[model samples]
Target: MKLEMLDTSIFIAYVVGLLIIALWISRNEKAEGRNTEDYFLASKSLPWWAIGASLIASNISAEQIIGMSGSGYALGLAIASYEWMAAITLIIVGKYLLPIFLKNGIFTMPQYLEQRFDSRVKTTLALFWIAVYIFVNLTAVLWLGGLAIQTVAGVDWMFGMIFLAVFSIAYSLYGGLKAVAYTDILQVVLLVFGGLLLSYLALVEVSDGQGFIAGFSVLTHELPGHFDMILSPDNENYMNLPGISVLVGGLWVMNISYWGFNQYIIQRALAAKDLKEAQKGIAFAAYLKLLMPVIVVLPGIAAVILYPQLTSPDQAYPSMMELMPVGIKGLVFAALVAAIVSSLASMTNSISTIFTMDIYRPLQPNKSQNHYVHIGRIATLVALGLALITAQPLLGQFDQAFQYIQEFTGVFTPGITVIFLMGMFWKRTTSQGALSAAIGSAIFSFALKFTFPDLPFMDRIGLVFLLCLALTVVVSILTASKEGDESSNQSVSLDEVSFATDRGFNLAAIGCVIILTFFYVTWW
Candidate 1:
């Protein structure tokens, strides 16, 4: 399974192309009157297309391109559930969540929390989210991207990790959200194209005797348990996690938290020019989510047929690239770099936003914009430095990178999701309640990870979410004001906004429900 040494030409092309895009966007970031709002929020004037591309690009990090593809290679098509179910989640967020945030003209999710709850609650959530955004999501992005480059190009993942970390910091350091969003359009296109090309080629290679449908048919039939919906904990399969219920449940909660509440991902939609563009952007990302499995997952599935004896599952992507023609290999490698930078820029901008607005401003008020933006640039470089160091160990343990990240996310997502939902919609939700819920949820997840790691992990997300919800309710009720104690300084009423999706979403939902049902029943 060993492949050729890294393709230097392709690697150089990818890195150079990304730098050009970032530099190109950098020119417009500091225009007169652009200020922080324009830089961070795209002047609140992004169209649906840009927002949509940014959303998908930021979401489809190297983790999904490499990790999810590896999951498909090992676990089969059922793993596509993660990408597909996300479509439904996006629709929910678009139909209900977008209007609330857009109508209020909020900047960060934590800013919304502050307006809805209190400063303490807002600051706590913002700080926690920034940590998770960097140490968690940002780390995973750099780790996976570096691993991919190392496998394909022998560039020393340590150096690749630094390259990604520094590149992300550079533009996000200078341009902020405008830079992040504009470059994301190019990244999104590259990711989709590179992935689709690889998958189509893999299918074509295998289907030489048979057609596309026939090749997959041969694979599904000849491969035992190829379509199995349920995997046993005791099964010797390398891909199976400890618990089925937990895996399914954990993934569902994680995706919801990411798509629905995460500030970094949702910031693009918030920057949309209007409600219509926001709605369109989110819904379009939803459609792209549905297509992700075809672009990403299917290739992993096809890889099993091409190189079945590889010791490391993560190598599936790199191995596939080796089989590609020389020029295409260079382009695909560039695409991988694009995917990595998109995530890096996104995380850097978000971390800067939370720190500057939520932390620096409140503690050190009356600072000049130049002074703060300077700090933001400094913070960007610092965050990138941290992210690079975090990925150092993961560079060698590519096999465990995906699992390690999931375990880390399992610790934070449940409670974070609950507090966000409550803060957004419930007028009764109190600052005390929000803080208490976060603390309780964190403690509960830590206990699970350390004390009872053998139990179902996904199932725990539901328990944690419910516990936070109940705790929030009790604390809020006890501290509930008779008058106006619940209102934050930025409160507004948007209970009557209407956001009707096209009939197409309904039809797609119906179609997906039926197809997923058939998949589960037949595979199980």
Candidate 2:
């Protein structure tokens, strides 16, 4: 996958073009009178298209491009359940979750917690999120991005890491969420087009240039094992994909935690002009999710057909790139870089937003909005710096970066999700009950990981979530007041109206479900 001189020049030009666009957009923000809302929430002015693009762009980072491809090489199309299930999750979040957050008019997820519970609950989870974003999410993106560039271009991994961090900060640090959201439109376009081109070229190579349909037929006929959408229990990777459990078990926990509650992903929907625009944006993103496995996952299966002798499954994507023609190689490489940088920018913006809105503002209340904006920019610099320093070492511990990320994050998501779901929908969940659930879930996750070493990570997450829910219920009943409960004042009322459905959203959601069902039934 080494680049020729012309290819190298194209790649360099693509990088420079992104910087130019970012700076041009940054100039739109006025120097003075820039408030916290302008910097953190894009002044709440993003349209549906931008929100949809930004959501997909932010989500499909090096993890999906590199790690999930690796998983595809090892686990087959079964791995695509993550992406397809996410489409369903996005619809659910739009129909059931967004109304609650939007109605409260909160900028951060922690703010919603404060409204529903107490400041202590908000502060505890906010700190937890900041730690995970810095140590896990941010660091993993940089490390995987660096590894991909090194594999394709022969650049040093550290150099790739720094380049990505600096490029993200250049636009997003100053212009804030607006800069990140607008530039993502270009990022998503390049990502989809470039990824599709790569997949098409690979299929053509596999069929010896007969055509896409012939190539696809050749692919499925020769490597029929690679098309399986479900894994049998006897299969070694069963715990990871586990046949029907992917539909009924902990995969739901993972998808809901990510699409419904994660700060970076939800921030785009939150920043939309209004509830209708946000719902529309989410539906648009849902459709895009249905197409992701074709672009991101199929190439790895193609590599299995074409380059079976390669030792590491992680090399699947890089090996596919080596098959591309000179000019197209660079274009595809640019798309890879675009995916990495867009995710980094989205994460950097979210880290700053959470820190300023949830952490810094509460410590020193009633400051000028401009002053808070200044603090946010500084927080972005610090977060990026921390990620650059820590990414490589953190990633070095894992053979498969994707699974490592999933297993580690799985430890926390179950507990966090329980607290949020109960707080949003139930009237009796006390602050003490929420706090106890949060703390106890972390302890139980770690204990389970060590105590029962053979338990699947997905099972661990489901089990932890149930335990947390039970604990919250018991603790709430014991601690509830005889007089009017104190927590009732802060409780969110979830009546039938709050989960109302519309024609457009309902149609789109049903379409996504039908398409996913068809894929599973035909492929299984």
Candidate 3:
């Protein structure tokens, strides 16, 4: 599937134009010299739209587009619970979590932990995150993205990886998060438009030139099982998306940890001008999440009828792109690249932030702000270099790298979630308790998995989360000082933080819930 010259030209122009715009957006900071705030937090000045767009752009990477599409082909719409549930999660974060983070005026998630708990808890999680980001996350994105480029554009996989790495660094290393966030608006716009166009064309094929509604009708009638929002216990894919557990079980723990506590994802909200602006941006992102399935998942469902002979489910998305015209193919390819590079830039920026602010700055606390910013840029380059060197060796051998990554991360997510939730709301939560939860997450997760070989992973995560929570509570109670000093400086001052939302935000939350309910009711 060699790209026509016109398609190749469109892709090249998109790449060049994005580089120009990203550099241009950050030119003032480059000329004037960036401080730690400017380089890492975007100078605390992101508007609602940029925050919203950047959040989605940074989130929907090659792994998601390709992986979720694969799930759509294999497990059907039940996999969409991840995205749809995340919309509600964003709203909860905005209403409850963002107020605490913004009130503290912190730079990173680890910084917040340090404020709420102790240095031991903060440093432990910080190191864990940095290691995972560099080894697991960065490598997976580059490898999966490279494979995607090879499939869609007929490029060599090695070249595709290098190109993505170089492109991400070119625009982002100099200007940092400000560059990444501002440029992400364009990336997200292209992603939405190109994805929607591809989906529309796919549906048209299913309808044999009939319109979208008719095509949708044909699909519903022919593939009724594919439309199930919740799987039955007897279904073969039940382990992947357990029947009712997605709504009430470990999935909530996973979503809260990712949306509320993850550095790369939450950095967008942290950079906003105020809590209200951040809340608005979060609400905006919630709506975009609601639309993601149509773009990323529907094409795979349509592919069941369009390309039945695909050797692997992951091939469904790129296989469907064969329906596009030449010019349209270029636009779609550019959109795919947009998703990849945006996520790369966002991840690298966050890695630099955690290292520079949480780890390096504490060790070298006397350094000037400019010096710290310089260190951040260097850290970004170093992390990207490491990922590039190790991408293939780390991920190339795995037939299901994305699933493996999720399972590995799941081991730690429950403990992490317990730490954050308890630290935020429970004044009795001690530093020792928090630290125990961090270590116990992995221990409890693995212990349960081996003990109950037949237990569904989602149910295991839910059970592990409960065990971690109990461990934290019991430890905190036993370790509390007689004079109350144990919980004194370590707890968030909830009285000083306000969780009140404006009328518009309340309305948006209601709308999101209503829409999600309609989706489940219709599909079920």
For model 2, how does the per-residue alpha-carbon lDDT over 421-508 read when each residue is reduced to its tens digit? 9888888888888898988888999999899877778878888888899999998888878324665544477653367767998999
lDDT of each: 0.75, 0.87, 0.90
Q: Can you rank all candidates by lDDT, best first?
A: 3, 2, 1
The sequence of per-residue lDDT tens digits that candidate 3 reaches over residues 156-271 is 98999999999999999888899999999999999999999998988888999998888988888888888999899888888778889999999999999999999999999999
Clashes of each: 4, 0, 0
1 versus 3: better TM-score goes to? 3
**lDDT score, residue 135, model 3?**
89
After superposition, which runs of candidate 1 have C-alpha atoms over 4 Å from their true positions? 1-18, 208-211, 230-250, 394-398, 448-452, 481-484, 487-492, 499-524
Over 209-316, each residue of candidate 1 has an lDDT whose tens digit, in order, gives: 466677677677766554665666665442334335523566667777888888889999989988877777877787788778877777777788888997877777
Model 3 spans with C-alpha error above 4 angstroms: 482-484, 488-491
Better of 1 and 3 by lDDT: 3
The candidate 2 region of ten consecutive residues with least summed lDDT is: 482-491
lDDT value, candidate 2, whole model: 0.87
Tell me the TM-score of model 2.
Answer: 0.97
Candidate 1 Cα deviation (angstroms), residue 9: 4.6
Task: Work out the TM-score per prediction.
Answer: 0.90, 0.97, 0.98
